[model samples]
Target chain A: MDYKINVEGQTARIKLGGRLTFSHHREYRDVLNQLMSHKAQIYEFDLSGVDFIDSAGLGMLLIAKQHAEASSAEVVLKKPAEEVQRMLKVAKFEKMFNIIQ
Target chain B: MGVLANDVQLEKNQGLDSIKVKGLHNNIFVNRESVEKSESDIKNSYILVVDDLEMNRKVLGKHLTKAGFDNIEFAENGEIALQKVAESNFDILLLDIMMPGIDGFEVCQRLRSQSCYKSLPILVQTALDGDDDRSQAFAAGATDVISKPINGPELIARLHIHLENKFLVNRLTQYHDRLADELEVVQQLQQDLVPNEEQIAAIQKNLSLRLSAHFQPSSEVGGDLWAAHELSDGRLSVFLCDLTGHGVVAAVNAFRLHVLIDTLEEYILDPGCFLTELNKRLVALLPVGTFATAFHAIIDPRTEKITYAAAATHTVQIMSAENMQINILEGDGVPLGILANETYETIQIPFPYGSSLLCYSDALVEVSDSQNRNISNQTVKEWFHEAKLKKVDVVEYILNALTSCGITWLADDLTIVSVSNETE
Candidate 1:
């Protein structure tokens, strides 16, 4: 798994690639730390490259959302692949984050 | 005439005395105090010297012998060197680079091509001092290089270092093999902790219940566990537990819970008390970061009631055979081992004849399809309703449906248990 971060003004765009599961906890934590340190007003996660996710992956996203909210920032999930979008819908993630096509 | 014979005999005596003196010098070289400590090491190690010239081979052999290395072999050329290596095991190889048929560099490269000789140390002895020759030797997999006029002490030190490393590698390989064997045994033992088919059948027969279950681990061992015990008072106690993670650590926790439940058989009638006591034991025994989610229930056939308590977030559903309706029971308590003083609550419901109660781990709801959409609880309830309408075993029906829908691999350990009252 890999991530590319692009920061412009107060918005940070993170593009995640590869499978998002329990095994990617360390990498996800590192990305989370980077997001917190940047203190971006808006955080956008680009899931276009992600192919698969599991229950633990949903839990990780929830944790990330909580962290963003605690820091007074808003998070949006953008451009998810078809499969990723379905997983998001199944987990009812739309109620938690601002999901844009 | 007598004086002449005496002088000839004196000359012969002097010749014998000179030979004895040379023998004494060789003995002194072999028995030196400085090399006494390494005598056993050198004797145990086998050294191979490959050189085309007979005189050079003799000189190298003599030096090695004097340094207390009694086991030495000679290879006149590269071809013979390869043959000897294949036939016997040598701790270190001393190869002379310049040979007629096959050069030392070619020999080293060929030996390194074989997996068994990948870590074998090949010391190159070259007469040429050019940088090109040294680099070429290294590129051909030479471990270290020595100049033509070999210094005895330097050779001995290099041999000792390489042999020590080889011995260490051998020891580590042995330890790895032993550990793998032990883990295999442990894996089998962990599988044995679950209730076998015969035990499940006997429980069903004795308690007048129709029980069916399915269990699969992502690896050799798993954290999911289920057991059904028939109480003496015509009651049945059933429980399923899923630890935080999977594999050996989770399997060990499952074994602990199995033993703990056996010890607490007296409290099996009260769901709330059993769960509370289980939480207390888990909080004391489990590590800080580990916890278990569980569902424990007691069914009384005479009263037709089920009392259950859960320490997880998964919903347990009871499908009514009367109206083909599904009633969901939500588990709202915290997972076990998380808090020291947390209490659990139990809910009682009527287990009417022909009604089935379904219990499953999170892996069931988390199962995804080809499009990565998870199987929602509503879909599962619908399947249960269909199974009830068809009068089939609900657990087997759901599993077969999932398999037919391309949901083969589960990301985590999965266990599903269903108990239905067969008495109508």
Candidate 2:
């Protein structure tokens, strides 16, 4: 998946698009770096553009949340696609992160 | 007949009777290639000097000894030269082309025919001006060609090149063999991590459940682990866990999970709790940024239901035996080890008689379809039903179904386990 991160004030909004799977670790690392670089109180993962997400893609989200939580930052999953939402719900990410409808 | 004052041959001519060198130039670095120990193996190199005449062997041996080549042997004919090499290991062969019986070319060809002497360095000593002999020696498998009336320094220098390259190649081959053997052990260990055929047969003996599983790892050692255990409560508990990446580290993590799962025997009937506790244990056990997507389910014959909780896994499906209608199970929960305080939802569905529950790793659904589209859960379901309708192997049908869909290679390990409450 391709992601564009925009940090304004204390909010870091990461817009992730396309498919996210095991092959995207290299690109996902950059987003993790962006999240750690710009410390923010609110980190939003814009997953609405992601059409499909496999287990590895979900694992990447968990990785992001772990990084975000370490800094006492709240990682919010924002605007997930229906399929992505179903994937997150199946994985039960609601317990870990607050999904923004 | 006047040699240089320093014992070096100053005059070069054929009339003075050049050393009639005869030996087999062959790649003899075989079988015991990498066994050479110590840095002086090259200098302490055992050399075989072959010639047809005693004068020739003595003359070359003198120059060889002067060049610090102490370990030397001689053969008066090519036949003896071939026999000596066949019996013992020589670092290099200084072969003389001119011989009475078994000429240098014939001896060299004979040695080359033997696989052991394939890489043995055979330096053919001949007339430097004879292009025909030089090419023929090379064709007969000579590692190199050195002229007769052998210059001591030139011979030593050429020997050093062949020996160094030969040893270096042996070391590389040794390292490669070691890695292959280690990987084989790990692959076997990975195979052992899952339940074996005997265990599956034991489960089948219960008569309440028909179980079949297939695990095909990609070219590498993958992190897919699955097992089936008969619960003390007359239930069957099975789980499939696929770690993030593959290879040694992922394999080690799988071993850790295997050990941890054994400790969770108390939660055999509770699929949700089993994963929750497993997740907590994994969080403490696994390093940060690593996790596994898994599915744990308990099959109860009394209730005829399957209670399962999935952590981002795919292919949690159940096929009805009556109509062969495949239903998808929503694998609910976050991946294990990602969150310390995570709750996996326990969703129970009816497992009517003649119904089968399938839980597989994501590798199945991630493949492309026949139309070049990625095979999703829906496509897999259709393929499963198609397999059942045709009365063929479901897993094989579905896996091979993607062959025309551009799934020429398995991108990841494919693992699937099915438990059917046939009761018949």
Candidate 3:
């Protein structure tokens, strides 16, 4: 997966493109870890550029959100790709995470 | 005339230093120290003495036993000699060509027919002094021809030659066996260096890379190497390298390149800067006159842009997405190990949804037909046209073309990697 991070003050926006499978988990975790160290209460994850995602990738996002919440940072999903949106709807993660279409 | 004590003393001193020997029809030298050590081992180095005359056998046996050889078995004729050879392992065979039952020629041929004694050294000790007798002995697979009465020095020299040859043969076989084992390990290491199938599939889905690869080493070890890793910024960096030589030396350099790439993956950010660091490391570490041709490119899937750089490599071609038109990417940089602190420039190419870029080693182009003719670029271009610009199976097609060109074996290591906009 390709990642582009735009950090504006305490809020950082992350954009993901491609498949977020096990191969990308390490790099994805690193991006989240970098975000968690900040004093921001909100972390924006943009998935519009993402083409496909598997269950493992969804689990990774949940973990990232949990970690962000512990640090008083809110992890929100914004502008998900068509496939990603369908996956989130199927998993019912849209209710737990603030998923923006 | 009476011999002086000084001459006797000189002979004794010479005997202490060296011994002239012949074995397997070849002259050999044996150091005195080694001869002493071999006495114990001689027990296992048995000999088969074949002669029609019992006296000849007895005298020869006594001579061998005096020389520290322990087991000397006798065969009265050629027929009996064949039987004895089949039954046991004998290091050397002493045969008389004029044997009664079966001539030495017949026995030697029979022994040679069997797989057991194909290389067993055969020395002919006979009273028949004709040139024809000597020729016949050789034709019968005789290792050496010694006319009686045999001098002790000649006998010892012939035996030493045969044993030395045996030791050398065994040593060479052992060396080759070890090389094969090491090749297996190197192959495993090469496999580990490549990104696994699952990883490639994952990256394909993300970057839409229309990537295909074919890696075949001509020998047990080769120099062609390639690696792909996702950068921290989500861009994928794919590198393909071919070291200067092939075999063990090339393999070592390829491994070193792997380590350099791993280190760069952890530390370096920009593709150009990464190559600079890699080149510096290679120049410092690799021996003079040795270098590598490398192509490193980073593809940002989100931006649909690629920053590509090459060092002493064939140009990377970008096929237009709309049509099959090709644009060659020419990156100017000296090959690794050629310059110090040399900065390399990368060309930013807009990789749209349906196009792909192809990077290949010189081996693909450096091919000659069966008549030893260079394969022209026009032929390659025609092949590209036939593939419909979709390089999903281009590797196989190119290899098949090269094979048809009469180039049965690749002279150098070959590597080809293509990243196209994934249509699937």
TM-score of chain B of each: 0.70, 0.79, 0.85
**CA lDDT, candidate 2, residue B167:** 69
Q: Evaluated with TM-score, which candidate comes out highest?
A: 2
User: Residue A55 CA error for candidate 2 (Å)?
Assistant: 6.0
- Regions of candidate 3 where Cα sits further than 4 Å from its true position: A1-101, B1-44, B196-202, B205-207, B230-235, B266-269, B376-379, B389-392
Model 1: fraction of native contacts: 0.00
Tens-digit per-residue lDDT, B1-424, candidate 2 = 3333232222323443332211132222322223234125677879999898888889888887886789999998988888899899998898888789898888889999999889888878886557887887899898988787777776765666566556656677898899989989889988988888888888878757878888877656788899988876568888899887666777888888999998998876788888899999999988765788889888887788888888876568889767788878766667898778887778888888777776778788777654667677888788777876786656667667777566867677889787778643
Quote the lDDT for B130 in model 1: 95
Query: All models, DockQ values?
Result: 0.05, 0.41, 0.01
- Candidate 3 docking band: incorrect
Model 1, C-alpha of B219: deviation from truth (Å)? 4.8
Worst 10 residues of 1 chain B by lDDT: B19-28
Worst 10 residues of 1 chain A by lDDT: A87-96
User: Which candidate leads in lDDT?
Assistant: 2
- Candidate 3 local lDDT, B1-424, one digit each (tens): 2222211111123535875443333444556665554544555678888888888888888888887777789999888888888788888888888877788888888888778677888988878899998888888888778888977656755665565566545555687899889889987787677776687778776655666666665565677888777665557788887776567777888888888787776434466777788888887887644567678888776678888777755446676677777766664456675456766666688887777677766556655688867664455656655565444466667777777776777655666676776546
